[model samples]
Structures are given as C-alpha cells and as structure tokens.
Target: MTSQPSLAKADSNPSSPGEPQSGGTGDTGDGLKAGLKNRHLSMIAIGGVIGAGLFVGSSSGIAAAGPAILISYALVGTMVVLVMRMLGEMAAARPTSGSFSTYADQALGRWAGFSIGWLYWFFWVVVLAVEATAGAVILNGWIPAVPQWGWALIVMVVLTATNLVSVGSYGEFEFWFAGIKVVAIGGFVVIGLLAVFGLLPGSDNPGAGFAHLTDAGGFMPKGAGAILTGVLMVVFSFMGSEIVTLAAGESEDPQRAVTKATNSVIWRIGVFYLGSILVVITLLPWNDKSITEHGSYVAALNSIGIPHAGQVMNVIVLTAVLSCLNSGLYTASRMAFSLGQRGDAPKAFARTNERGVPRAAILGSVVFGFVAVWFNYQWKDTVFDFLLNSSGAVALFVWLMICFTQLRMRGIILREEPEKLVVKMWLFPYLTWVTIAMISFVLVYMLTDETGRKQVLLSLLAAAFVVVFSVVREKVRPRVDA
Candidate 1:
C-alpha cells in the first residue's frame, strides 16, 4: 500500500484534531457554498434510499424468495447500515464533497482514490440517462404527442439547469421531489398495515393478513437458496443511501449532519424497506399474479381498494425517476469536482462560477448522459447493454472499498487523532471484517448466476481500465507533496 498522505493542518484551531484544514488538497476552495439546510439534508437522507427500485424491483424479489424476501431486505439493509457506519466514521472526521474517494486516498492510496472516484462518477452519469429515459417513458405515455426521446431531452435539460444554478437549487429540488416519495411510501405502509388488521372501511381481500406469509408455500417457498438470489435483486436499490454523506459536505454543519444520517440508518432501513416489504407480502400472497402483473406496490394499493392504483403509482414512480436523475447529476459532478481538485482530473472541472456551481463538471457529466441516451435509442441491444452490464456491480465495488478504507482509516484516527471519532463503527475490527466477508460472499455468489456473472465480469473490465489509467497518470504527473 502507498504511504498515507499527511493531512493539511488548519491555521485556526480545529474542533477536533482530525478535522482537515480548509486549504488542504481535499479542500477545493472551488467556492462550493454551504447552502443546504438541515431540513434539506434530513429529507435527502430519508428519501435517498427510497428509489424507484423499491417500488418496481421489489416484485422480482418477492417472486424469487416468496415471503422470505423480507429476510433478503433485512440482510442487505444490515450490510448497508454497516457500510454507512464506517463511512460516517471517516466523513465526520473530515467531510469533503469527494466523500469516500477522499477517504480512500487518505487510507489507501492515490490509485484507490482515482479509480474508485472516476468509477463512481461514471456510474452516476450513466444513471442520468437511465433515469431520464425512465421518467420520459412515463411522461410520453401521459402526453402521446411528445416523442419519448424528446421528453428525455427535456428532463435532462431541466435538471441540468437546476444543478448549474447552485447547490441550494439542487437541494431544494430534491427536497420536494423526495418529499412526495416519503409521503407516498409512508401512506402505503399505513394503509397496508390498516388493511392487514382489518381496519380499512371496505377492504375485502381475505388474504390481507399475517397468515399470507405462511399460506403461500410457508415462508421459504422457493427454499433457502432463493434468499441469496433475492439479495442480488434488491441490493442495488440501496445505492443512493451514501449520497447523504456526500451532500452533507455542502451543509451548514457537516459533522452533525453526517452523524445524524449515519445513526439513523437502522430505523430508515427497518421502517422503509423491511416494514414496506412485510406489509407487501401481508397484503397479498407472494405468488399472486397481480403482484407481478401490476407492480408490488400497485397491487398492494389495489388490494386495499385504492382507486386508480396503477395511475397513482405511475406518478410516484415518475417522481422517483426524476429524483434519481437530479441526484445522479449532482453526485457525479461533485465527484468530478473532487477529482479535479485532487489533480486526478482536468483542472477545468474544478472551476466554479459565482453561484459556486461546477459548471464544467456538471456539463461534462451531462454530455456523457446525452451520449448514453443516444446509444439507448440506436444500439440498445448491444452497446447500451454492455454499458449497463459493465456498471451494474459498481455499488458493490464501492462498498467493498469503503470497508477496506475504513479498516485503515480507523487505525490512523486512533493513532494521530482520536477526538474526531465521533461516529464510530460498531465492534471495530470484528464487525468491519464481517462486512467484508459478507460483501465477498455476495460477489462470489454473483459469479454462480449467469446474468450476475456477466455483469461482474464486465464491471471488473471497466474497473481495470480505470486502475490502469490512474497508475499511468500518477507515474507521469507524480503529485507534489502538500
């Protein structure tokens, strides 16, 4: 491993000794303003994990694992909670827009930082196209006059402009976008719970009770093997949960925000993911045709006699797609800004305008986003499929890196600065090792599954390319010591 870089010392007394100085290499001074408020940060943290995946992807998990899909969610949710705890530990010590990328640099090396940072940025930029197309499909269905591609273009442009305006604009837009999702999911859970207890006024589905969990093949309908398969299906839904730590870098109090979001992961996962899935299976049998014919959420809503259930879900799902696109652009650009500040990317990407927005970084990501959309329209079956497959396992790769990075970072903090250890990972080395083992197990499991094998192989190919580029760049440029 490369020797860890020395942290830049603050001229003013730091709240904690581990806190980085404002002029450090990690500090861009690109003029990113702390405009995100506590409310915005709180909602972003709450709604970040509630993606379109939960609404749409849960059906497959339910089908694959039967009622035991709840177990899959709980397992993945535990992994995420552990991963985020480690991240929170580092982020609270020295918050930066670079996030885990910066932490990787301090704990591992430039190679780790550059490779992981660019890979993550690439992941989100591709997500922009995926999400915009998703939202556009729904809009085009509503107003048939607009072409699907045209709607995609419109959605991208609007969100791009919102991000370019300022960090606060992105925060405000996400605040309301996520608000709608929170309300929809919360309402669904409440109604479903009521129906489960026979409290709904006109509900008539006799299967809407706790007994449905066992009535449909007795919990492990497909056997214990299917639970692992369900993990692959639902694990990616948790990708955006780390975005709150990233956004916290731009908030009024970075430490407090990171700690709050980190500490709250348990309840968020319990209530939002596990709670919703339990309610879903309770409302309808796992094998019911409607669960797949209409999405799990829609079927659950329909079970309780909600009018226009499909249409209502379409609106919420569309909102989720837009929210993902908005957050994706923000995340990718901020990462680009961090790379530039750290000398891994072109300096132009680090430049911000009067609004403290990285216009070049945002535009750069949007350019690739547009290109990906074009590929989707032209060569979706081949080129687009490759792109999609290659990035599929990036979330796992990132989580693995976080675990390794935290292992080293924890030691460094203890030796050099302990006071900054405000948000600690549970059980230190033991739980950290357990998280690593679980992640490795998932990767090995993916190798056994055909589709998953293809994705992991292709994603490794992409990661290898970035690693080579980072090594060559470091050799040629050789970072000057701070």
Candidate 2:
C-alpha cells in the first residue's frame, strides 16, 4: 500500500503567511484547490441543515406519532448537533477533505478510516441515484414528452458536469438551489403561523390553533411508544447535516468556516426542522386525513386555501432533490479523493486537473451513481433495494465513529496542540459518551421493527465485508508512513 502519513505532524507545522494552507485556495499541499468562498460555505451549511427528506418524509412521522413527532425531530436533531460538535472540534483544528474519516484513522486505526470513508462515499453515491430518480419524477410530470429515466439522465449529467468543472462551480449551483429551498420553507412557516392564529385575511384555515396539537388524541395518538417509532422514521432525514463539515475542507478559510457551521447548527435545526414541523402540527390536526393523502407540507398549504399547492410544493421538492444530487456528487468524490491520499483507494483518485478538480474521483463516483440509477430503472425491487437498505444505516455509523474518534482525539489535541481547540465538544467526555449511547440505542431499537431490522442487518453485512477487506489489504500490503 501507499504511505499513510500522520496528519498530526503535517497539520502541526504552521504554514508561512504567504503559503496557502493544505486545502486553501492557492495550490494546496494536496492538489485540491480552495474554490469555495465564505458566502458559499455559509449557504452550504444552511442548505445542509435542510434536506429533501424534511419535505418528502415527514408525513409518516406525523402519521405515526401524531403531533409529538416534533419530539422525535428534536431528539434526532440534538443527536446530530452533538455529533457535529465533536466533528467540528477536530475539523477546526485540522481541516481536510477527509473530515471524520481522516480523524478516525488518526484516532482509531486504518481499518476504521477505510471502512467509514468508503461507507460514506457509498452512502452519497446511493443518495445520488435516489435523488436523481426523485427529481426526474417531478420533471417528467411537468413535461410528459420526456420520460422519467430521460429526466433522471439529464439531471445526473448536468450536475456531474457541474462538479467536474471546479469546486466553485459546484458551490455556485448549490448556493442558488439551496437559496430557493430556504425561501420556500421560510415562507411556508411564516404564512402557516399567520393563518394558524386567524390573522391571515380571506383564508379557510379550519380555525387552526394550538388545539390541533392535542384535540385529536392528546399530543401522541399511538401512546408514548410511538415516539421511538417516530425516532426511527425521522432519524435518517437528518443525514445530510454532516455534509457541511466535509465541504468546509475546500473553503477559503476552512477553520473559520468549520467553527461558524458548528456554532450555528442548533438554530439551523430549530428553525428549519423543529420550527417548520411546529407550524404544520399547529395549522392542521395530526389525525387529519389530508396530511396523509396530500403530504404534510402540501396539506398545510391546502388548509390555508393556497392555490396550486401541490405544484408549488413539487417545484420546491424538485429544487431540494437537485440540490441533494449536486452536493452528493461533490461529497462522494471528495471522500474518494481523501481515501486515495491516505492510500486507502486508487492513486488516480488523488490526482487533480488544471482546475484543481479530482477528475478521476468525480467521474468514478458519477459512474457508479449512473449505474445505480439504471438499477433503479431495471431492478428496483431486488438490486436497488439491496443498495438502499445497505446504505440506510451508514449515517448512524458515521456519527457513532465521530463520537468515538472525538473521545480519543480530544486528549491528542490537548497534548499536541491545545491552542487549536477553537471548537470544543460540549461537556467533554460526558456529553460525548451520552451522544454515543443515544446513537447505540437508536441502532439497537431499529431491530425491533421489520423494515428497520432489514436495514440494520443489511448495513451490518456490508460494513463487515468492508472491514474484512481492509484487514486483508493491510496484511498483504501494509501502509507505509511518509
């Protein structure tokens, strides 16, 4: 295997004022160019907090837990906040495209890094196909002349070209895409709140009020146990929140970008997730049939006499799907590049073009993504389901690894470079351990349900396969240190 040098030593050496940092805009120690500006980082961070799942998947959570689904979102959101904190502590000190994967290698071992990094890349590539299919469905609806698969191919190719160009191009596309989603959600929340209080003029809002929260079945319709079920339903929706940490590595000021994203995550989750869900439950009773029939967001819009609500929401959802596709491609490729640099992947993946783009890595990820899209078209039930289930639980695994890595990395950072601890994990080992336990509880709880159980078993099988491969690779060709 190629050399796997210690990042601690590399990051410890201060760069001259004239020389750009490893991931900075000028020629990096690694080949990647820093093309992301502060504005791009800010928008990416905000966009990461809002995902397509929030719009598409909240209906089932509300159906299962009644209005108390807010609690499930809060619990999962808090878990994500803690995980991002631990990640931020490491990322701010030593920024890299690898993000938690590299930190795992330094704190745990090569096996951990190789496994998590590849799993993360796997997760995003799968997401690309999933999001591409979703976007295509909407596009095919607007223009029936184009088939769903045709739209999917068009969307995937366009975004792939965007990523292949430069990091700035990717950021620019994401900036506007995310901006539209933010405005849509923000508008929905504001208008919904006004209508709920009987303040909006000329609207049939069913006299919407706080009574909707409890009048149906006293907050939780299916008893308290459903909250756990709701947790299972909503947990995966928060998967994209960590993408900001990975994107920060390519920013002009990675440490500052990391710190800002970490600090703002709380309010971001509160406003985008908890806040919007609160509006939905407040505007319409949890047991309302329209919510399940027309979807949570659309139902709320319909209740307020909004015109063409479905189409409007379709447009918003399409924007979200495209944004996810854009970011997923960028994220998967960067992780692959990082893996190559660490000697965990092919050396070609580490090479860059004149634009400082990892052409090989980007194309590699897109090629797999396109293949997955084909699988979705040709054999969605068999091969596609296997890919989906195997990747379903990786978000939890990544978070759990971050918690473990932070526990060990905190001491290492304190001993080696105490001054660089600009973003410390809250409450140290105590909160970190609590976060770990919560994630473990969620994973264990997944086994109780049929769907969740299938996902866990399949994901574990995939993880074990990768771990075994990593061990064998290490034994045959041990990593060399630079």
Highest lDDT, which number? 2
Tell me the lDDT of candidate 2: 0.89
RMSD of 2: 3.2
Candidate 2, residue 326: CA error in Å?
A: 0.4
Considering only N, C-alpha and C atoms within 3 Å, which residue pairs clash in candidate 2?
none
Candidate 1 error regions (>4 Å): 9-30, 480-482
Error of 2 at 361 (Å): 0.3
277-361 in candidate 2: lDDT tens per residue?
A: 9989999889889989999999999999999999999999999999999999999999998888777887778777778888999
lDDT of each: 0.88, 0.89
Those runs of model 2 whose alpha carbons end farther than 4 Å from true positions after fitting are 1-6, 10-25
